[model samples]
Target: MSTLPLFPAVIIDFLGSATAIALSFLALRYSWSLIRLQPNNFIWGFLFYFCIAMAAFSLSRGVGHIIKILLIFGNRNDIWHLLSPFSGGINTMLMISAAAVTIYYHKGLQAYKAIRSEAEKLSEANTRLSNSAEQLQMLNTHLEEMVEKRTKNLSESEKKFRNFFENSKDIIYFCDNDGDITSINTSGRNLLGLDPGTTKVNFYDLFCHDSDLLKYLDELHHNGFVSDLEMECKGKDGPTRHILLTANAIYNEKGQMIGCEGIGKDMTRLKTITEQLINHEKMASVGQMAAGVAHEINTPLGIILGYTQLLMDDFDENSEDYSNLKVVERQTRACRRIVADLLKFSRQAESFKTSLDINLIIQEVLAVTEHTLNIHGVTVLRKFDQNLPMVFGDSEKLHQVFINLFNNAQYAMVEGGKIIIITSASKEEVVITVMDSGSGIPDAIKNKIFDPFFTTKDVGKGTGLGLSVSYGIIQEHGGTISVKSPVEHPETREPMQGSAFYIRLPATGVANHENEENLYNGGNTGIR
Candidate 1:
């Protein structure tokens, strides 16, 4: 045991204390860096305080060791004794502080772990809340879009219904319980001949007859609806219209009848067409029957005429028997003539058709009938358009038609009158009007004038076949014959105090001048 071992021990002690102090200072510096990065962190703050305590302990112990070595080398034992206790006490206190701080650091670490877990849970909750908020916004947007689309669809449906209501062709109307009109469409207004601005009108007043209105209301009241109920409706500016009406009773929330709504289909034109078709069918049947009867009666009529003539020859003149025989002969001849007219009316003879001027045919008819007309105190007037078109028809048949019209005019005016013959051209047809300033035909018999065996004159004066034969001839030539009486003035539709017969024939589209010369010379003309 020498002083050499003591020097080695002191040197070891000083080096060990300095290494501890350096390591503690480096640890404190790193802990300070951790604190700077997370200043409020409990773990880092606790660790930094523990590092400071360790550093202070290491510095105090290392300084005390170095002072002892210096003191031993300088042989200053008394001063070493004085400084050694204070340095040792300070190192002890720092070691205790470092140890206490290390124990408390573990408790702080447990608290820090709990705090970090709570923070993570809070972060997860915040993330979930954000997602929920975004989903809510998306749902709101989708709901808004659905609402907007529904609104648009509703608007479109309303517009379509409104369009149908306004533009529908059928007469649509609504009326109140008291037969007062409430609302009506454009077609309804037009059908009733109402003004554009008219709103209120009595439904009962629209009916052409009161009986029809009463019947319609009675049926409607008995049943809640009416379908295809036919009725005539009066107009403000025209004739009554035929309609097929369908209606449903309108009701309030309490189911009490408030009014009625209906649609009316116009059937006026259809009714006219039906009547014409029926008339055509009837004429066809009558013509067939007439032809058969005329054929069957012709031979008997001829034999009766031959026998009557033979009887007349046997009787002497100025005798009662002779007079009676003459009467029989004349009546037989008249019957034969009627039979001949029936044959013509039934279209039994084949027609000879050619393109000819209607004016030429009329002139020829006048040539034959002018003398007769003048004798009857009837004057003839002509109104022929110069640029007349050609018509393809039988000349003989047309001559018969004009002759018949002239004779009727003469008979109609017993006192005397004027007869006018007018010829004009249209776009596709030729129009001829035979007008007479005589007594106009009675309205009751006007429609019957063209029926076979129907006549207004006394039985012995006429055979009642003239107009019917003319009608048949005109029909065979694909023309129309219509009568108006009293004849209307050309400009004003007022009556001209006479009767007018209008004939429309299809044009041949050929110039009338081509056949004008041939017509006078009877070139292929059948007017014997």
Candidate 2:
């Protein structure tokens, strides 16, 4: 130790101390700048703190070296040697920790660089989204304008179609495949006898001859179009109308027949006049013989009845002669009735057309025949509609018609039975049905029952002309009278014992027919 060069050694220790202090200060300053860059980051911030501690330890070590040199100058090398190991150990540990912190800081810097690059990409994507939003807004505005323009055009088209449909002069109609009227023009409704605001009505119900209607429906079903088809239809408060209709089948997009559409030209008045001319010609020919028939038949028939009555008075009550006289007298009276019917049939009386409630008419007829009905052991059941409208016709003539029908029903029930009478009305027509429970008429004779002198009764029982006269009277009133035998009672569900006579007549408005006072002004009828 004495042989050592003290001057040179002292100079080296001071210079090393100065270098350590300066380097420590520079490293500390660099680490502080790094701490500012990533102050909250664990990897970088902890690395900077560790490096700062290492710099401080290095600064202390630099001071320790200077102290050792001072101690060597004081000849205290043992004390200097004792602290040198401590200072060296601290410096080595700080150097190793700083190296580890440096590695971690480098890894964090790489991760931060990647995150910054990703943020730049996100900014570009946001710019593209803004451009797309502007394009979509322009497209939406154009679509709204196009939709508004199309809607206006469609509305105009529909308006034009509606005008054409409503203003046409001819009657136009649309019906379903089932012959239900779906839509009809004003003229069509008027011709078909429907009031304004009629809810729903069937198409085939408008036709007169059911056979003709059935044929027409069959044709339409097969062909899907009907051309120049002439048919009769009842009109609103009017007579049966003749119409020449042309129709086409309507179809859906799938080519199925959804409905039918048609136009009808009215020919009612013309057809009626033609038919009247024919009927008048026939009547004129029949009237020529009617007078001679009355004159020729009355004289002999009166003489035979007189002589038979005289003979009947002379003979005993139980004798064969009296029985023969009774037979002759019975036939003579029947002959008289036949002549009376002929006269009435030939001469069509002037119709007293006035509105009258049909249900009231039924009650009156029932009143007149109720005693006779009780004698014959027949029960009368009346089910009449409460809202039936008044019908237009002659009340006296109508009364005669119902009386004949009721008498016929009485005759039908030979044994104790039931007679059900029903009356109902629709917007256009009034219906009356007289049903009896008795032995039904055979179908073989139904067609001929209305012919003159046709009878299903015993020799003295029926004049046969009763039904014929009834048929003629109903026709004169511009009504229909039909019969159905062996029909099931709608309500009772029993097989009706006899026959049904269904009569339909035109319904007249109460306000329009001022001359009529017979109509029930309040309600139509009640069950009795």
lDDT of every model, 2 decimals: 0.85, 0.76
Model 2 bad stretches (over 4 Å):
1-292, 299-331, 348-354, 492-497, 511-528
**Tens digit of per-residue lDDT, candidate 1, span 408-521:** 988889999888777788878899998888899876776678878787789698988899899999999999999988877654566678898999999987766765554445
Candidate 1 regions exceeding 4 Å error are 1-170, 183-200, 208-215, 236-238, 374-377, 414-416, 439-446, 491-494, 514-528
lDDT of 1 at 185: 83
Candidate 2 backbone clash number = 3
For candidate 2, list the clashing residue pairs, or say none: 193-235, 193-236, 438-497
Candidate 2 lDDT over residue span 1-528, tens digit each: 368657887788789878977877787787778778868555556656776867777777778778877888899999978988997887787777778777777677788678767777888888888888888888787988888899999999998877776777677888887888888877677666688889888888788789768767776778988888888876657667778888888889998988888888888667756765665565556645665687688789899889889889999999998998898898899888777767665544456767787777777777688778889898887776666777777787788788888888887787778788887775588888888887887866766676656788898777666666676777777788888888787686766568888998877744233323443332223232
The alpha-carbon lDDT assigned to residue 483 of candidate 2 equals: 86
Mark the 10 consecutive residues where model 1 has the least summed lDDT.
519-528
TM-score of 1: 0.63
